[model samples]
Target: MWRCPLGLLLLLSLAGHVALGAKQGRVRRELAPGLHLRGIRDAGGRYCQEQDLCCRGRADDCALPYLGAICYCDLFCNRTVSDCCPDFWDFCLGVPPPFPPIQGCMHGGRIYPVLGTYWDNCNRCWQAGNHSAFWGMTLDEGIRYRLGTIRPSSLVMNMHEIYTVLNPGEVLPTAFEASEKWPNLIHEPLDQGNCAGSWAFSTAAVASDRVSIHSLGHMTPVLSPQNLLSCDTHQQQGCRGGRLDGAWWFLRRRGVVSDHCYPFSGRERDEAGPAPPCMMHSRAMGRGKRQATARCPNSHVNNNDIYQVTPVYRLGSNDKEIMKELMENGPVQALMEVHEDFFLYKGGIYSHTPVSLGRPERYRRHGTHSVKITGWGEETLPDGRTLKYWTAANSWGPAWGERGHFRIVRGVNECDIESFVLGVWGRVGMEDMGHH
Candidate 1:
């Protein structure tokens, strides 16, 4: 009597089949490209074949969509010898690795030449939350709409609403600014993935922005979810799902995080560096590794029932209160992180073939989920000239669409763009002082 994961049953779809093995230890299965499963194995009716994750024989596995491997949480699980895979929640040693800017570029704010137009990452943008990513109107929808349903999916924020507010005449701007750039807004990035701190990330982004403007003073950047997660303070880990005030407390203690490297043992570890410049494979190597499957819910926060959002805002609409804080005080440039899935594009789209997220329902590629409000620009076109609305920022150079620079939208682009800002999970590392 196996029950499907709460979230997966509704939206999860099976992708390529994994080679089944003997019926015994935890079942093993591979996921689509880039979907790394950090805390579980795809044990679909397989048996005693004895496949292992991190092979440490203790904690569960944390599978990410990409990176072609899973992170193992052994030792913490206590059962040194077992057939069961470590549960996502039971195994609790989470962390954030160092992710310095690569090749003199920030994550979502890079200067690149696109369509013969050279765009500057920061030229017309405001850096909100400075280094962390943001959840604008659209992204929030993606999260609420699919958070429980989809894993490893990006939620780009929809900015059509943003435009409506900024330009009352329903006029579009060439670009918008970010909140961090706002005079007195709090510039805190939530301590996420460093410990599954998304709960903290979201809440803090909203709360901090609000409080910072209260008393016309800087927001209470003292939100620290880590304190709440501290087993010492409560029964939770210093790194579970993040929340607004809970995360605010955490960020007040520690700022932002990118949770990038530190290869966990027994998973697809390191790649030979001195790797060639980011060039498409002239000849594909052995079909590179696959994504991770088998997801387990984390129990650190207040529930095993993933913290569902209460109608805080009207579905896709931003809290007018918060938006007021965000808009007037913000126009900040949050990190522009493109998802790893963005690289999974197929042939006609560009030079590469569209790679699958491995699963049928999940997004095909990792695209941008973070957005920034750059400067508003008026363009002269037909119909007495029109204003193009959009934000500017960085996305990994790997993706297409808004991957290289802040993307311009006629307003409400598409799912990828919508999920881009508020699509929840994203990695944000600060830039070197001189780089921006």
Candidate 2:
């Protein structure tokens, strides 16, 4: 359910299992020199090797139609080929084939290669009738599609002199997590569905976390991204995507009701249809002074249900300063760019690399995205280099990217994550006073 960019939406919509359609070459009955077809005789999926064929192991079985035919091991074939024997046969004969698109990785392994090619069987693409998903788009195309509308300076705040003052002991822990230290304050990971509404999701999630943490859990409540997506059309684009600045600005000025009052509809559709028209009920609830349209039913703003953010400001790019804010207040929203290999990420610390498995065109920064920065940590690599990482919450469902969370290389401003961090003060309630 991880959201893709607007431009990728069209391409992602077209991704699917393309038929290789390699005009079935004539099948050969006689064995050729240095060719060994294993598992064909038994058909029970056993391995056999010949010295001339050079089968590496059990999986390298050259069986059936691939045994003698000049099988076309093309890119699509490598992705969707029914038999594993052709790959083995090609390898034994010194024929190089493109790497498979989809790969497996241990849940928490330290070492995993980033896959280059698009996943041939992405469920999202299948659902959308597309041949690929986010991984299919090139870096430049993704960047232009996703970040084309973002305004850089809009995220900058004037609070540099205030939170940048990091004390010696409280600078930053080697590792920290808002969810671990303050589970009550951390909201659950949310799914943006197929829409590019990550700006709204991340902004609302960070604000919700900050509200709960600042109020010491007394005023904990899940804020509504639907409210922003449906009602904040003046400065923000609903499903076509929006900027973090505009989302925060909407929260500060217009305010929003709880999710119960303005439930999310953008995610209800798996196809990620266009954003629904601004609901009359939500619009009336979000506006401060505007009276509810008398003819519109259930369109009144209630003081008890309404919540507003005050003094939303951007944080400096300093890593320790960002950590200090999270430790003191709560999670902050991070604007970032992503690479294609990110789709293959399962777990462990992630850092962008130029290539994966020696493929020079892999892992390029493909698109812009936003997430909630909840924690920070450091890990020691085998080479003795200290790898600092940031724990961020994704808009995709918990089924993806480490249970809806990911750790990226930190301190060096990887993917511009350190740049344009934003924080805000949530509306305080009377019930929260005693708790704090």
Candidate 3:
């Protein structure tokens, strides 16, 4: 029963040696230069004898979950799981660590973990770790504290009446930005400090842009937000917050002096009272002085001339119509409801995303806000999904979000930005002048 042939035994032995030799050869090729492929058991740990490389405990620890326990010196190592293999960190870690924190804006990509959070020092805000743009304040607090200034009773334009109409297939420009048309007109982002006068700041800025564009560069006035915050209290409650419509009406009625005449103090209150008196003293006091007003300290009377917005009206909900208005009229003011996640936006087209798991409640829904819609464009994603975006300017300083501007998902009334968009013609005439 046990009769064996010498030929059969020889064949089996040859096959085993051939298989073992093939594995050894493959390992030799993979080993680094000068490293002899040999079996070794030194103090540190087991060396992969076949590959002539040290197999650190981490590699063996991760072998069962990732590659099999058969360790090799190939590209199968994961930095997250086992440092032995490179470039497999994301694949093995499941949720890997994020990129090292850096300055300014950054796109969320493979390098930056989708689960890590970062802080934006320039704007004094924190961002949830994810693939979305990061802004300092979530939409809610930004609007509530900075933008929710419009009063319902103080609305000057009748919102119920729709003014814009869409002609079917109206071939609009693919992109439109006020800054492009009038580069010198776009003012730097204004800082509201601790006050919630975004309504006043944005309104004044819109007026400034319009005046510059409409006058064909003849009139470029940095209309005063302090004037609106200090004097326009009849409808608005001072820096406590005012409505855009109300601010526009006030500008039309009483008008406002230039920032040249009244410098911005960041704070809305004067030490004397809750509302500060509009200092009519024309002088080169604080920053933001132009050559025209550089030496015009004695020209107080000229600086006091009130600037107004004429024929201010509401924009329609139609996206194209709004874009058309921006192209034709210049920058317009729009109210946006800020979601909680909006505050962490560093850069990129902003959209709402759910709060990351285990994040604080601040990542939840916040409040309403206002911004100047400067331009619009369509962006195609890698997956070929096309998204329209509104290039909106924020009052936050240039250090924040795309040099003081942010792109929000457009067309679908993102954050209700398309709702109640307001446009105005700055009252520019020969009579509007400042004596230096």
Candidate 4:
């Protein structure tokens, strides 16, 4: 008779039987001289089982000859190469085997293990614990909710016939600022909130500056965007979005009131809510002008006079012409393609980046946005390169980029900003100045 080891005898004594469920046809098979094993299958389709093969404590003898290879039945097997038999968990430990090792996450033709992360420029992409991957919000949402200027028709875009004549003998400065030239004349930037009404905001801002500058600081009125949002409804979508041509047309024809007279009510509780009713209206006062017909929305403000501007004209895409127009007049209105990354701008000369180049189409969106170009300057980089930039006023408020203003690459028509530059003259007559 083959003598069982002391450890095997101890295990068999505790089991109270030589085999498991012999009455149910579960018989022990002799594999080696003294080793009797029960039948079970592993992931590799090899037969394995827990007989008296488990090590009592930490012995190297707790292994079985499995298909010409050694498969450990010891507890130490879990800490090493995990070469334990499949039934070692069920028969020895009374538990099911753990799930198979999860495969790595695949993206952009690369495999990333769970919890792996990588940064695509400013955006971070990572794999989650549940074997899934996640990327940040789509660019479409940023364009739809944050920016609101619609692309102008080709006719409007190509209407650059009206150019600002440069002086033959005069020399333009390397850098110039409208606010510095006419202090207290340029209007500070205003917040458009969630409203996509850059059309109204930029129009009103540029008009306000021109009105003040043209009047020699006599009539410094911050024009109301709410007046245009609520009243200028012909082919306009209010907060949803609108065309700059329509905004300029309304400023030239229907006219708008001062912000003090009719404050901005474009910020809705929900972005989809309807704009407030037209609180201020005007009646034709002859000479292609108008006077306020309704009382000022802000009752405290008694100046209900309607502010108007001359017909807007486009400026040539030349940087000198744009600079000359901005310096000679006040700020000029410009249409730019606001890319998804623009919203992350804190400071510096802005330009569209290729960070989202490998991203999906939905993550690389751009929308038209209008802004006021107030000045231009050049910065010397560490690499001895000079960066020319335009200082422009945004409608996102003062707490944002560079105190409600931003600088963008100049001369290259970056984001089509210089592609459709426009300037206007405030309808400041003798009577308008006398009132101030």
Positional deviation of residue 134's Cα in model 4 after best superposition, in angstroms: 19
Best by TM-score: 4
Candidate 2, number of clashes: 7
Whole-model Cα lDDT per candidate? 0.27, 0.58, 0.58, 0.70
The C-alpha TM-scores of every prediction are 0.30, 0.65, 0.61, 0.69
How do the residues 1-436 of candidate 3 rate in per-residue lDDT, one tens digit apiece? Answer: 2223331211101000111122344343234221111111011122232234433322222321111113333344323332232223233343332332222222332122222333211111222221122223344445455555563443443565346665777788887877887799877767665567888888888998888887777788888888788767666766667777678877776667788777676553232355666544323322312122232223553545456668578777788878888888898888887765565465677766543434455435456567888998877654556767889888766756777788888888777788778889887655444433
Q: Give the count of colliding residue pairs in each prediction.
A: 97, 7, 20, 0
Tens-place lDDT per residue, model 4, 123-194, is: 111111110010232356557655778899888877755766887997888899998999989989988876
- Candidate 3's TM-score: 0.61
What order do you get sorting by TM-score, best first? 4, 2, 3, 1
What global local distance difference test value does model 4 have? 0.70
Full-model lDDT, candidate 2: 0.58
- Tell me the deviation in Å of residue 114 in model 2: 10
CA shift of 323, model 2, Å: 0.9
lDDT of 2 by residue, 261-347 (tens): 566776443334566766534234333422222222234534335567777777778898888888878898888877655554556
Off by over 4 Å in 4: 1-138, 269-272
- Sort all candidates by lDDT, best to worst: 4, 2, 3, 1
